[model samples]
Target: MKPRSRPTLARRLASGLATLVVLAGVAVANRPMVAVAGEALHTYQINRESYKKRYGHWARLPVPHDFRVNAIHAALLHTGKVLIIAGSGNNRDAFEEKSFRTVLFDPGTEEFTEVPTPTDVFCAGHTFLPNGNLLVAGGTKSYEVLEADVEHAAGVMKIKNESPDHGDRVFDKGTRLRSPAGLIYLTRTRVTVPAARKVTHGAHIMVHAGAAEVWVDAEQKGDGAVVQDPAQYTIDGLTGDDAKNLYGVADKITREKQEYGGDRTSYEFDPVAERYVRTGNMRDHRWYPTLIGLTNGEVLAVSGLDQFGRILPGRNERYLPGERRWVRAPELKRYFPTYPSLHMMADGQVFYSGSNAGYGSDTEGRTPGVWDVERNRFRAVPGLRDPRMTETSSSVLLAPAQDQKVMILGGGEIGESPVSTARTDIVDLDERQPRYRPGPDLPKPARYLSTVLLPDDTVFTTGGSSGYRGGAYRGEPRSDLFNSQIYRPAENAFATAADSTVGRNYHSEAILLPDGRVITLGGDPLYDETGKNAGTFEQRIEVFSPPYLFRGTRPTMAGGPTEISRDETASFATPDAARITSARLIRPSSVTHVTDTDQRSVAVDVVPAAGGVEITVPKRAGLVPSGWYMLFLIDDRGVPSVARWVRVR
Candidate 1:
């Protein structure tokens, strides 16, 4: 019989605090409890009663440190994989120790695979590049002695029970993974591409519906004859159909006493004559901002820390490249706000939230509500179950239900400027207005965390420092914190999610894999699994995968995408089948969606084939709204045709 474990310190603390709060002399009417079903998922930072009592504290999986990590960032790739970007783990022997913590979790098999990142690298920020790959950038790593910083890839983190450098015999310096070295320290990663390729200027939070562009870094070129100098750059207006060319946006990095020498904006040159042509400029200057490609061939750059390292100011800014205009937005008011996350709903509204700085305060500073795009304004996000939370938490767009979407806030901390709040929360955006709901509480996440949307429609959260027992505040990576969990909000379930198969943190990135796996690239590189060390170190990239999963229609061998040749470095993340690789190409079928899950199947006739069959569009499924069709074609034997967006007349 499987043995049952007792509740953890974090969980008990949350429950105890929740129990003590009384409605006071006031009737419970004003603050109604957030009712939830047994199957509802509870977020780490927000949960049911998170508002009523400001309850739910650090409740991590009671599992032993045996590789269990604190909390980290998350990335969902096109391949359906969830990348767990961990911070501080049990690894050694690399230059970049801090950013080295990482893990990969495959939702397909619920397994966690540990892969070390390169040195001095922290995937603090990144985005999907053109050519469907990913562009990881901007972060740094260092040694435990608080020594000199480096620019190379930092290795995995090495977590010790009581680290010596941290003043405990349990862990000492000169630790390494396999080889002996010291611990690593990582900071935000800085790089540019894919994003730069799309807009010459920075446009935040909007998606470019049909623009095509390309991105190139300091690497050998394969297609464009025009050498794109390595400074920040982007190349817009690729030939032929606007949607056919992949556009990459540029990101910039600035550090004191350092001269990476670059303009806020630039473009790559493919001089091939048939390649992309540069055109238009974004109206404003945006650095390291969130850029979303709209279905209308436009990109919206969202709020970000400025080149001067300042957060949003009195007024936010929006850039519309199609109109080539910069519009000032509502003053960015917040107690302490981090970058607000952006997600375009099925109904066409771009939703965002302001987050807490994780300093630990309650009422004065809180979360920024939602913004209704059609009205082009901000709406107070009411009924937030947890009042302490600011929009800064990493909230993701889950599968839609009843025209309402459940916004799940994954593992991350809350609070104002000084104290951090360890809790969780979920908001149901089903009604015209946002309603607060509660789900399962988090298993780990004392420091803070991130979440990723899975291809299968589940949510995976991972990594964070600081726990209930409490040791260090910042710069503390642990073994007991070694873990990545999954919260199936729809099913109301919580399990030991080994999705990306590794623990990650600080500047980490997680991208979805086509075949339902997750690929986590660069971040504060850590050290060995057993708590070893590497001196003044850094690291290399590692791949994470789960057990018992298939490589469905891998994109790699797909005739190398009838795309341009410049992306020699570009490789498909999917496993390729020869028949499908050489299979015939089909044309687009005009179609649209009537609801979130309702079917609007399109067709593609195959050569010399009869007796048609059906293969549901796993990716495009549930991705449509009324008056919208996720239409695409597939040849015989279930090979997919190129996909495009079209309006049903």
Candidate 2:
């Protein structure tokens, strides 16, 4: 009865299809869909060829030497090479060894040449001058130590023992001293003890003398002994933690005062010679300042820690390129957070987008607003959500600088906080009342992101972390985000690009090369695969080729003017002039810490000429600040040619 009837082939097939349909339904039901504001967000279609075409390809370049100098700062020089500044390499031992470093990386040759750094330029701010020189200001002098020193007058009660030139002595802990002496004694009493004495039993002493408190074993040194002169007891020896504390304190103080005073030492690095020449020092010492090129061509140096490690006073300074000196801009009585992201507006005023590289508090210039440098006033611009998430964030002046729109993206809370945000917002400064409006959200939350304005009027963003700066805190070793995306303003959308092989986080940089490829290098992910701290100094370099590069043969620039005047038609030879669709002038980047305000792309009207195309450079200084730019000719297909260097004067 059980084998009475065997099912037909068609019946068996129907049963299998039913099972498949049931499993498919279950999988679909369980699939998670991302939502924004209770509304399901649509994942835009990723055209692999289109993605590969637009985002380009990435290739890792071999590091020339085992350069331990982590690229904490990087800039694209007019000479076509990237300047990498490491400064002390972020290692205390390296800093003590005077291992401060800088490197010149030639993208064309894929070679690296070591450059000499006169001082510890670590954590400095820099921008490109009109003449194409990079003006680097502020840097680490010396890191503060945990232990400190104090002087006190304590009576040396007796010389308990003597051995040749060295001797052991006792001091009276209860001895009463004078005003200043008592102040020191009271402050250091419980924390430390007199590790060294200025005088021995035989030496003369005033009623009171100086003493230094240090960590030492009180049981071994014993108490004070009566003596005619406490000054006579010379400190010839120390032991245990006292020796360690004294050595550490002395080393820090010495370096802080002597070798690490570069906060006030400003310099201009001549790209041609690849050497840093001394420039006029700033009015105040700066350790993490933001140097922004104003529309007038002068550089405004704002914020930074002073020599004493306090936020620099509200009095900022302006660097006169002609005078090569920094003058106090007392009239511009505004302060900003360290590495504040500032963009020049059409009216010659500067806008702080509330994005900083992790320094300064809300009261001390962390507010977002448009600053009138002339009138010395800040007009607050509302609508930026999560002000606390601005640290390590990035901002960019949308393409065709004439639009006068700025965008801010991706940041997190300061000081090793694990929280990050993918929030992006844009504001139109040209509007009567400018305020930020929500822009496209990032694929994921990130910090330390580098945004590059492309020739095709698109913004290419890459390299960041989901954690704090470089994901160094909270055991986030794999926090580096290799995914890259391109923001198209025309559609107000973000298109995903190819993922990079290297994890670039804190102390990393990405700059657009003259040939249109992007060179990304350096990173410190807290630790490397070797389980050694050495990997934190990421030295490898990777180049990303965008989709346009894969398109048909690139257009060629036969001949073009090396320099052009504002509002004038500039003619350049192009075989595909008839096919040429757009012309752009991209300012070379001098970027660091996601605070590159100088890099902007200006769209120019192009018309076909006899054998080339005639393009007009914008007359507005704010639209196209006078500087060397990489000029590109794009065909109708959006394929850009190798850029020709042009000076917009």
Candidate 3:
């Protein structure tokens, strides 16, 4: 055979063009076709569809209080009521007055009932117990501050041999007082004393006498000594960093400080009584801790600022539902970053996804890995290109809880950086050698994004800011993003959904309701539309009705066992058993900071029966954790009926 003859230039060009045409056709077919307000658009564009046939629509709900009271934390209870915890609302006035507020919202009645918090639970960590009670731990003890004013004195130095109550002491000439960090001032003059002593207690060096005042800085724990006053020389003054430091003072004063101490108080909210009852407190004070439910029906509390606003390393504790107390878990040697996103593996292990809220250093508990609770050992899983960017990132166990796959979405830099990344990555824990693989990038770099897993096996993400904590943007309306997107795991693609009426950013939350709708609430933008310092809290509640709601009529579910046994077929009555295609058990949410590891949607194996349907609950506690879950019946068109409450044990 003759050597391969070179093809003509025209033939080569034709072949290339044909190949391009085929590739283009494939791209067009694979790309998601999104319909926005009756207009079709490709997946690459931002589609503003308030009402789309295949997308969700947001409806503003009328709250009894007119607005949500700065809802920083929200949880769905088994009684179909939402527990909104405001806890001083992050306001200085409210915090100072000890106005810790909480409310129970009844979606069915559209009413809100005020619940009293025994202590300030602001910025605390919470999770639902197997008994359907919410266990909230840690909070603010007092607002710590530092300032120069006399009201905000740092400490008190008593003059040696001087009357503790009386003042106006005598000092010698050429005497000087010094403070390492703050200024020394005369309490009577209200003026800072010069570093060098030009004058003394007396007129001359022979027997000069003068009264001296020393003003120390706030948070100063040392005592100042008198330099002069040769005749029984003594100098004393009051000093402290903040109000909490005012130990012996009777007057109440406010001081300027950046940090606050964490509280060791804990409470359990009873849905039936609609009240928060004081429970056993934690061993260590924890602020911004992450509470995750374990497979054994206990809650693990990890990572938080201590009473002095310092990162608490190796301070792990477990909450017992029966005892209603938090016990130390000293075996857990590994420390986690603040608010680390933890998910339970099928084999009863906890996986830290390296996604933290804020605070903590890279060298301290920032590694991502699967943690063995029994052994207290961590198996590190590398492959995250930008592990440092996991701050404020969102991670979720993909649809069908049994999949054992976790996907982490957009996040920002370690600290309060304006920079954010749209990159996404996923890891399959089921693999023999698990490692992270690149996933689809987000439409935009977002922080504080709320990821809600829908009943239709689709992940719905909404409400995040392009800036740090939803501020510091270059365009109009600041940094908040109202756009929403849906992630389809089957296609591994993201499609534009509906745009929310209000923008949400930091301190915001979104959770799935029993009726197959999502309720988005509480956003603190930090600034107003004019870029001014305005505490713009998005208090309006917006409910999103998923596209499945518009897909014809929904099936009706009734008469299911209140409690379910593992590995057993539970029977339930459905209006259309032939049309029922799937059954799912969704754990009720106790979400905050976009880190809710307790919420999981487990798909149950369903089969048609003589009356309704027989659903088999997984025997493994890791698959269907011992707790209350909402049982939903989905029709062939993927429309789910109103969920009925069921306890899995």
Candidate 4:
């Protein structure tokens, strides 16, 4: 080839500049076009019947502007309506203004109704009762005050009354207490101290002092009034005899970061009345507690931060459904981290799967174990992979509760650490010496993953972040995952599902509805897409329809008794009776923070009758707790029918 003469510097510069300008123009023109084309292709692929048949489909529900509140908790009622509770929704301003919210959504009609929320039930624990009522107990009493924002030293003070003649004494808020050094502190809330009691013990009269605790803040600002040792203080306003009898005691007071306080108020949501009914207060204030309904029709409340922002130190209580009251259960004392994933096993023991949402010491109360309530004993299970990363993880009672298998999924390091793991492990509680075994790893490291069990004996998991509160990870600005999968226990594998349109992380929940669909809501990310500004709580809701829904027409069940006792057989009319292979009674989900002890599936033995099918309820009350359940019949093809409301007595 003929060698061209080298261009002059000016000529080369002009040519290079011209080429640069042309390339820049092309780049700018293709950016928007490429995004549009890619989105179009994704939409086409996901909408295709073949794709939807293999995987599932996700769609966003239209929520009215006024009805849209931050969904901090969700439960599916027996009436097929959803109860969504926000209760300030982690908004400090809203909590201060008392702008709590609760709404009811009817999935059948897609209608919304606002309900009056009496208190801040945010971060509270809830479970379904035998009568189909939801027992909601303990919530946010006070928001956290970071060390940088704390203005004064504070501590809990116990007031004692030693005079048997005096009646109960009520001290209003801001009551002052003076220490020996003349330092003063004010009570943060009103408190009532009972009168002293005289008891006869072996022919002797013993007078016992009555006491009550209240939070107190130093009267003076800064740390000058901080006390490091146990001390007694005199009541500010009292007579000569009263002053001696009524005294305050405290261990220590310091200018430290104040964690979120728990509330003692409790309520039972009456599904039929569509209102909240006040119940007796819990024995202990609790935030991030877990309330699991026991086989005896009572609820066991465990693991929460107290009103003074201290973990309750294993003290637990129980709710009496008959009297609508909570009583201290001193015999069943067991400690656990806040929001522990506790499930009641078939043998009536609670299995703690080592998954906790946060707010406890990393070294304490994080062991996977089986707790015997009657005997006050715990047996730890070994061989959990990445055990230190159990915070913000999820655990589920594998489908067909009879199998007694539990699986713990993805989690991150304690506190707000950015580290996460894709680890998954399973343990069979039925084994004599059950130990955790390795399972398939997740596609990526994740936290706050929502796992739901379906009637088809498969678990559907979706929506999590690879970082804390959906923050930045690796080189990405945000780590909210859209991918989903279906875990088949029979096959011991996972199949890919459709991606979610919205992100779900901390404070989010996924509930299995009566019609065999899962509705997912709520995500409180630490940062927005840019990872630079505070993220807004996600108010949008999404629904996922599994592949079974798109397979073919589902079996139909009709005309069943409203109540059936254990060991009793009930007949239900169904046109597809011959094709039905099995039946399941699935308890509805009342979930928050990815911890749901109420959701479980009990297999029912079914036999084809003359014109319908008869299902024999299991005789074991521990396997199937007394409560309302959605009865679903699954055909041979693995498709389940629309659930029929049934109550097991």
Candidate 5:
């Protein structure tokens, strides 16, 4: 594992209570706080006590031998299971465990099962295929699985270059932690007795448009697999480190400083054939660029910094397979300095968020801005919500009553850099006089956070880069074991979550399990520097769910009990209604063939004030649970609303 810079000092210990609230109630979100965006869904928070745990209440999955957690990546399987694959791990200290192993977690069972971590190369930011499989691409060209004789806890993944150029891939030697390495995809499927294994569906889709432009791994080896020397005969300009120093001049540099690239790479994979094939070339040179899939089936390659490590001027292009031509979008407001986010709304609008560009006081390239998908530029877009660099200028989205209100939950003066503020201005695209709603604040700075829609309308966010990057080689790093937290819809806040007990930084991924639990995997990475402050940390996979979802975890307090009942579909809101201790619902246990969508919708229902309300349950004959079956619960403000899971015997 590469070392990251250590925090000279720790920011005041993350406020626990503050963490819970800031996560949910930020004084202000990203921008256009209150925006008339789309329909609204009831919101809920991920705060509950059962999940908070009392005794040895929290259960951690046992990681494979030798894997120290570098980073963990997660994806939701359509079958209500969350599969996790841990990224490359580095052995930092004799005391610190080695990572780089992968695991799978069954949130409903509150169990963590291990899986296979590709012993080939390091990777992240790969595409999540429409199918359940995950697509990983590029990291170090010198990536090689350690020799079998090496101890599992060994820090070196130095595989013997025996086959040399035939089987498996290799990471570029001396590659930095942030350097791009390998890229591959994984899918999950289920088949009935008579059927040829049909993939029912999945929850872990939606990552920059179904693998657009097939960003080929330029460093991949021919390994005797080459029909063509340089498969595509195309080469990129970003070669990783020379003997351990990627992204900069090498130890043995001539004059004029050395430049990367020239190494042949390919990012092509055939979905149907399940084989990788070389294809087209990128419009220009872009290292670590953001890729977004447009509704019309076109892929957008956003701007990236230049070889000199300077923020390139605003440059973005559109690539469509059929066209084989690159059309330019509005010259980006500025170079997408780093880790830009490209979001696609349900309504077809492509949201392009220009991440932090190096500081520029000049208006033309300074504070970040947004661009609407210029009509005909590529395709028609329903709408686009720009990132607000200014506090008051950003529009905001509010929490709606019915599921029809499209409210803005986050936006503000938060820049792409590490040090960002979370203020909010709500914008109702449909409203004339839209006033922004100022919420709470983040317990600590969060960047590159992932956003997901909860049944109750609130959003679930977790695992992002923390600390502020002052300038070129200066920023804070993630240290210690910190479990990521959940964001609530009702309070419009964020809170300390349970499953985030393991460390993860940079490029880690979180997927919502079918039963409402979150399976987080990947992130066993070191920083660009030989310091311990960069990249995602931890390689262990953990599942985070409300108390009820996982059995046997609750506060055994004698505070009587409050119960919610709904045979088919149940609901409730969090941080409201007596901070959910254990929210469970059950249907007829006698019916085996019976099935139903146990979606839990949470709303504040004021029933006759029984010290604890015992709501009645509903049943749909044999189609539903015949007897009684417990539904999932929320603790730790764990879930903003009720989260449902299926039970089919």
Candidate 6:
């Protein structure tokens, strides 16, 4: 046998270099595969029993195709059913077809039924009356037209009748009016002007003209028909005395953007009958208003765009629930941006949390304050960081209504500016001079985040986007966040929870259910994942069971009084009385667009009785507003029992 000779030095070096190149190529090719494997491992770990028991779990609800809706507004009724309203669902075609919809969902039965919606309640305001009826008021009377889409210049025209003997004058649609420039404009709808009335003085008499306003569009399209200055227009068909008696006046007629017009219709949704009962109409048409139930059982409606597509100038009204009518609240005149977060305080004063849906003048009504509606006095509160980013913020009165503390969560820049903040501010209203103080920051900048107060006294926040309606942020195409966190007020810190599968942003809501789970629904994103196509509304509902629910068996409540009065004691039968540690009387949420003034948890004094527990309701009307509440008994493990419906009088 002969021994083999060694290779040349050049050959050896080439072979070694080839080996290194192949290894580098292999490492580069396996990078994506390694990432996938790591993601799979993390998923499996999170799904394990130990991880779920610690971080909680999320499950999606099965909704039938026939029962699906856009869910613009949602309220949990006293009958343990959820009322979802989608009047036209923000779809212009649906509004044109008058296809309004409302649906009732029973979580226990997992059943859904459609309720006939008579009007377009999209962008309406609602609050719960003392009788447990939900009063829904104001909605979209007309959709907005952008400047680019405006083919004809338009403006509101005031028609005056100066002749006292002419009686009522009627003009049908398409009635033409001619300006001094000879430009013609046609009325969009019929107009009726009342006859002028003669006023008598001690020695003289004067006639006051009667006027009616109607929307009028330019007869011809283009800048030629645009009128920049206020002008008096003559009625085209009128002649001689009729022409002098009736004339049209308009401030401007230009192809500018037109805002959404408001509707004056109102209704009371009867939970027992499962139907909407017609109520008296509001005096002023409103869109994006806030109808908040006062301590006296009346509802105060404030801030919205009126029928003429103009922001109401400090006009507010009150709804008398018993009389079923609305009257102007001239004395309570105060302006705010649309859908302002107004929380009723224990002393009947309302606290404006500085959180509002984007609308109105940016600087005028953006101040945080305590408004004394009775005296028409407002005192501003300072120390709010990133105050300008409060347009889409969420504000909640912290747990234990007696604390009188409010926390404002993440928000974005005014309008659709694509800027967001992670800052959270808390204010103790019980202070002599209430001012906001900074709290822990969120994990990431967020907007339209939904915050739900759980029965265990913890606030669970989840599902928001870092951009404008989940569009673009920091150069990312879409920015809907799935991360969930539980904020422990006691610790003043946030703990990670299991991530949700769905992406929720604008038009989303998180409601705490009677069974100790948070149900989340509705998301209207501006763009899809590719950031090129329009996004669709999220119809799938997700339910979150907190970590406590996965810990062990929950406490059970068997019997309880159906109704209780303020400052009174009530007893209820409970199987796990020994383990029961605390009691919470939580108001069910009537929420939309992160604006829910109806939700506040009242801590009740609990004492263990024979095989049950006794709880006392607070005496102050502002502390516990008259309405239906869910009473939950929490055990030592921080697990809440199934709630029992209890009405507070």
Per-candidate TM-scores read 0.44, 0.76, 0.78, 0.93, 0.44, 0.93
Task: Name the best candidate (by lDDT).
Answer: 4
Whole-model lDDT per candidate:
0.34, 0.74, 0.76, 0.93, 0.34, 0.92
Q: For residues 55-102, write the lDDT of model 1, one tens digit per residue.
A: 112222222333334323444333333444443322334223344554
lDDT of 2 by residue, 1-649 (tens): 5767867757755765565556556556664321221121111212234446665777777786655358888888888888889888677787788888898888788778988889888888899888899999888866644222212222212222222223322333332222211121211122223233345456763222223332211121212221122232222244554333222111111111111232688899999999999998888878778888887789998888776565766768899999899998888877777778888887788999999866556556777899988888899999988778898889999988888889999899866688888999999999889999999999988898889888888888999888764544345455778899999999999988888878787777788888988888778776565334545567778888888888988999978888888898888998888789998999988777777878888988899999999999988887888889999999989889899999888
Q: Which one wins on TM-score?
A: 6
Model 5 vs. true fold: TM: 0.44
Give me the runs in candidate 4 sitting further than 4 Å from their true place.
1-30, 197-207
How far residue 162's Cα lies from its native spot in candidate 3, in Å, is 27
Clashes of 3: 19
lDDT of 2: 0.74
Better of 1 and 6 by TM-score: 6
Worst 10 residues of 3 by lDDT: 244-253
The candidates, ranked best first by lDDT, are 4, 6, 3, 2, 1, 5
lDDT of 6 by residue, 37-119 (tens): 55555665665567788898999999999988998899999899999999988889999999999999999999999999999
lDDT of 4 by residue, 94-204 (tens): 999999999999999999999999999999999999999999999999999999887888888999999999799999999999989999999999999999999999999
Writing each residue's lDDT as its tens digit, candidate 3 over 488-572 gives: 9999999888788788888888999998899899888767876667756778999888878877789998877999888988899
Stretches of candidate 2 exceeding 4 Å from the true structure: 1-51, 66-68, 146-179, 183-262, 470-477, 527-535
Scanning candidate 4 in windows of ten residues, the lowest lDDT window is: 32-41
